[model samples]
Target: MSEVNISELNDSQVIGWLNRGGLKASADGEIGLWNEAESALGALSAAQVRTGVSSGNSLQLQARDVDGTSWTSFLTLTAGNTPTCAIDRTVIGATTPAAATFTTINGKTPSAFGLSLWDAADAAAARSTLGVNKHYMSLSQSSGSAIGDGDTRYVTEAILTTAEGYATRLYPMHTGTITRVIVQTSCQAVNGSNETATVYLRKNASSDTTLSSSVQFNSARQVYDVTGLNVSVSSGDYFTFKVAFPTYATNPTGVLMRIDVEITY
Candidate 1:
């Protein structure tokens, strides 16, 4: 909706950027004035990039649809340990762009990921080592298609101790890192019984990577956050979850899965 240029940075932001660069002008003659100008932008450095969330920095660029209800497209550069950058121009049903919209202009300084043409790389690959390759990551364990990787699931199978099947699958719409996976079921096993269902993240039916420890079914409402997982999946990868259940006296009804991902598109 609103956007301010990077030239309008405040005093604090300038000072922070200078401090981060360790820029100290050397001149004994001008020490009197130089000391006062410690907050000067003397170096090519920026300490903090505005965390563009609800509100924070002065330099921000945000775009919304006409109704301003759904976020049609927004390219917000968020600052954190994972200094993520996201740029989305998904105007699916539009014939032409509206006013103040960024157009695909040519005839400018072209950019390759590497310094030399021999050293080739993509945009996401270039920023991976800096830990900023991640674009946007979000999730809600609750049901809905509004979140980043929608957790809306429909597993309509009755699982008994005798049968275990591929109860979950994920078709990533974007390429990113899956940071977390939460699985909550309608049951948990008793202390003595071995009513356990081990879940795995299987891709293309090749190697089976265990998502979490064995999920035992006995209690009414048992939730398990899958551990030992930091899966990096592409948009084309077919990811299916294999649930293998051990012998049990009491069978479970269904399984609910939620995946929190850092999507870079």
Candidate 2:
């Protein structure tokens, strides 16, 4: 037996070889050849990778079946957000993201950008770099003899007389804007409709500046706060919480109690 050069054969000779079965069959009958040809044609082609604007504020990255009947979605690139992929159909003009099975974000590494930002020597340095403020103040009664100017009692226990004007003398540790002034009381003033808790800030040796608006309290064992404030302050600034009960049925002695300040830099 010798190897035949098929290119050297004439048309009739080639036809003779074909009629005698030249192409090998992988399965029974000629069906395997047809299936192989169909598979080779049905596989994904480079020309099917498509990209275009299907609608306003929307995009389509799609593909279709080689049979020109069925379709599939490979990577659907959204406009406003990162690209996420899912499913096996082509629904062009997609505004919202797909079902979010395969998510792909477009920025950052190691969660907080990098590991070097968290490295610092002291607690203060670390707080500074991380943009976090840690300040806590539990101001109690100031050690004074009388009840008018030097009285610094936090109204819960020290408000003996209705005329004993008292407040909490606080020295701020951080430099920031006073965002919240929270007050906690054991009980409400007996007739404290006209009563209020006011905050004051005096930087260095300046005049007493009223920082935030007054917060009224009526509920017992509940939290009351003065929020939505932008009171500017610096370190070593003196602050005061004055609970004023101008008109009262019963003197709110043990009623007006605790004060907590919140700051943000």
Candidate 3:
């Protein structure tokens, strides 16, 4: 028979002998044998447990979930100076992290602007809201008077002068509904005679389709609403504005025109 005296050993030696004999000792001198059945009995409950290391200026106790996928700090103990614990939510892998709720972001209340959530897919792309409403305006000017003898001329280009006017094509930034359109023009006749003018909004190469009825110009500045006159335009679709003056005259020189379009997605 093998015999060992526990009173003849130090604390570590006694612990080793007891471990070899399938016995465990708690901090308070309680000795017991642990088995699979004992493990299923209950779990150890404690708010704080020593890590068996010397206490430093700061210490943090972290624990991982049962799946061992994520780790979270549970307790922090400090001795000298109080250390700050900063929790950062940054994904180190390619997959995005779980979503979190926040009242304010970057010091601005998201709910104030009706912003509720943001879905971040990756580091490069993120989505906040859906469609947006936008407005655009283009202006063109001509120096000399072109005879308006019932001929269609692109209003965006200066036909009678060498000056290059604004772009003749309007490209929408997004595919949406064209809500409104307004055309404003300022023209004068050199002979001081009243001239009739017709403005047409053309899409693509279909110039026969009139967006609006012929607007009569009385040799003065005027604004006309062409919302109901023009057809709906898609994203990247080009728009052409044409002006026709059947009665050519020298008085309608130095024409200034502006076109405004509104789109909603």
Best by lDDT: 3
Where does candidate 2 stray beyond 4 Å?
A: 1-109, 112-131, 140-167, 188-219
Which ten residues in a row are the worst by lDDT in model 3? Answer: 36-45
Instruction: Give the 10-residue window scoring lowest on summed lDDT in candidate 1.
Output: 143-152
- Candidate 3 residues 31-108, lDDT tens each? 433333332111122433222122343444456656878766655544434334434335433554567677777887
Off by over 4 Å in 1: 1-168, 187-194, 253-265
Order the numbered candidates by lDDT, best leading: 3, 2, 1
Task: Encode model 2's per-residue lDDT on 1-265: one tens digit a residue.
Answer: 3555533443322112322323222222121111222221111123242222222222233466678786556555443344433433435446533443222235433444334343454666666677786455654322221223223333323442333233435667778777776665554334234355454443443455454444433444555666776777786676655443334333333344566777766
Candidate 3, superposed: residue stretches over 4 Å from native: 1-132, 142-144, 157-167, 188-192, 207-211, 248-251
Model 2: pairs clashing at backbone N, Cα or C within 3 Å:
none
Give candidate 2's TM-score: 0.38
Each prediction's TM-score versus the true structure: 0.35, 0.38, 0.43
**Tens-digit lDDT track of model 1 for 124-207:** 555664466554432222321111111212222322222223444456766765655666554322232445666666665576
